[model samples]
Target: MRVTLYLRCRGIAPGTVDLVSTGLKTDHRGILVFTLPDNHPETLRLGTNDLTALNPEGRVPILLLPDGRKMTQSGPIIDLIESTLAPDDDITLLPTDPWIRAEVQRIMWIIAADTQPYQNIPFIIQAMGEWGMVKDNPTRHPLRLHFIRREFGAIENLLTRCAGKFAVGDSVTLADCFLVPQIRNALLAEIDLPSEFPILSTVWNNLLDVPAIRAVLDDAGGIVQPLVYDAEQFEVYNG
Candidate 1:
């Protein structure tokens, strides 16, 4: 059975991938696509709210797992992060230089896990701040976005060193996947996109062409269009 994950990015902020692009089941039975909210309650899942109660065993076809305790999409992305970068002992793949591969993995780490906090938390706060939707003392709305930007700002500088075609290393890696969506939001959050973030923005631009990511954005119909870049033109990378 093909399973679809519904993600709500309406309130997503700048510089981070949040309820937008984090779904990762990778099941072959069905293709993943975003559905409209008006079409909601009709899809497999109502919203992309990260309900781990769907699958407990951490199995494939994550949305329809009928047994065990459910694990959220978090587990799948984490496992992918580790496996995709880990060195392979099976010599069948590449007999190339180990040092180069190791360096590749190192850069992937910088883009994927290292850059996450900056993209997500800050983006959310910034979005909330923009609409003045943030609440008072019960929540530290005063400091959320400011604190997050400090982190993303650091990442923009780090990109100056490791960037080329992507945020880290010459080739695209997990970092690119982790980054593109966040960049979309960052732009939306109106985060200053000056030359200081050239490298980071470059990586975000490159990711606009990935078929999987593109498919998700393209399939998302109506209202959600404003949430993604070039939803007006179906383009993720403006450059």
Candidate 2:
């Protein structure tokens, strides 16, 4: 099946959701990726684009299915990918056991719902403006750090009970897809993961070694690029 993903170009500060989508593509393969302009999301927010037509929320990581349907929001998009996987597929983003599945979802949500949204660029830009602070204000670092550290701390504590080589187990799951990117964000914020959250640090290190995860990082030059598509120029990977 052909799938098209719309996302932003991978740069110094990559989008969190974009990484999740890219990680999935690395595992699932046969996905066509289109890199969007960096300003694409800002255009939607500034009333300059019709991105809302595809996604009411105006977010990236929009997945266009082969059947001409579109899926938005990373969590639901991940769900769609998991649902469509054949039983014999080599990679299982979501585990089969009920308890393990819940554990996986738990980590995914902590990053997706609790961590990423709060520290996202758009939100941080607006927040700094509201406080009448300059873009490079020293205080801004703490704001981003607070959210990352808080969430990482909680996940660290949980990891003691659930983690193995990865977030929840030895194999990569949806949680790791959601996690590695967040760890990148933390590093961008200057938070020392190994120093603060040892368990997460170990998992982050292990995740980097996985081929799917490593390829995603290497392809983006240590981050992830967005998906913007042109019918003629799209690249297809059938992993």
Candidate 3:
């Protein structure tokens, strides 16, 4: 069966999440990946474009399934992929042990729920301009760092207990798919992973060597460049 994955640049969290998740599985060889260039005409038209019909949120990483169904949101999309795999599949993103599975989800949620949303570019713009939050004019605002640091601190502590090589164990799991991208975001935000969160830093460093993670990073263009939001341009699409 063929699957179509709609993604944006690696800088975007959801895209990176799906990219890493799909790359990890050997059964996904038939998947076709399409990446929208940053600020492309099609991308600028997201909210009103044909794409909006597929996902009203106007987000990337929409997985078009073979049966003419589409799925969105990184967590659910990853879960769907995991669900389809054979129980004895040599490559699994989730562990079979119930308690270990819970640990994986715990770390994944720390990044997915507590961290990424608060640091999203549009949210940062609205927080500062519309909500009257204090503005620190960095590529990623201080407000973004506030959430990143807070959640990453929690992840770091948890890693000290559950982590072996990856986020949960020596094998790569769903948590690592959520993790490596957030660490990329934190690094882009100028967080010193090694100094502030050493365990997470080690996990991030170790993941870099994994073939699947490396493939996603290579496809995503090595290190992520800081996102630059043009207010006038944003208005054209979001208005």
Q: Score each candidate by Cα lDDT.
A: 0.41, 0.62, 0.65
lDDT of 3 at 205: 88
RMSD to truth, every model: 12.5, 12.1, 9.4
Candidate 1 stretches greater than 4 Å from native: 1-52, 55-69, 73-75, 78-144, 220-239
Error of 3 at 82 (Å): 2.3
Q: How many clashing pairs per prediction, in order?
A: 10, 9, 0
Which digits, one per residue and each the tens of the lDDT, describe model 1 over residues 199-239?
66666566555454555556644112233211222111111
Lowest summed-lDDT stretch of 10 residues in model 3? 1-10
Say which candidate scores most in lDDT. Answer: 3
Candidate 2 deviant stretches above 4 angstroms: 1-49, 131-140, 223-239
The TM-score, computed over Cα atoms with residue i paired to residue i, of candidate 3 is: 0.75
Task: Assess the local accuracy of residue 75 in candidate 1 as a C-alpha lDDT between 0 and 100.
Answer: 29
Tens digit of per-residue lDDT, candidate 3, span 1-239:
00111122112235333332221111121112233444544445553334456666656567666565779888787667656545543555678899999999898888878888888766665565557777654346777888999998998889888999988989877788778777777877878888999998889888887765776666655645344355454444334
lDDT of 2 by residue, 1-239 (tens): 01111121111124333332321211122222222333554444455444555567765667766555778877777567545545533456668899999999999899889988887654554454455534542223466677888899999999999999988988777788788777777776667778899999999888777765666677555743233122122122210
Which candidate comes out best when scored by TM-score?
Answer: 3
CA lDDT for candidate 3:
0.65
How close is every model to the real structure, measured as TM-score?
0.46, 0.70, 0.75
The alpha-carbon lDDT assigned to residue 223 of candidate 1 equals: 10
Error of 3 at 34 (Å): 12
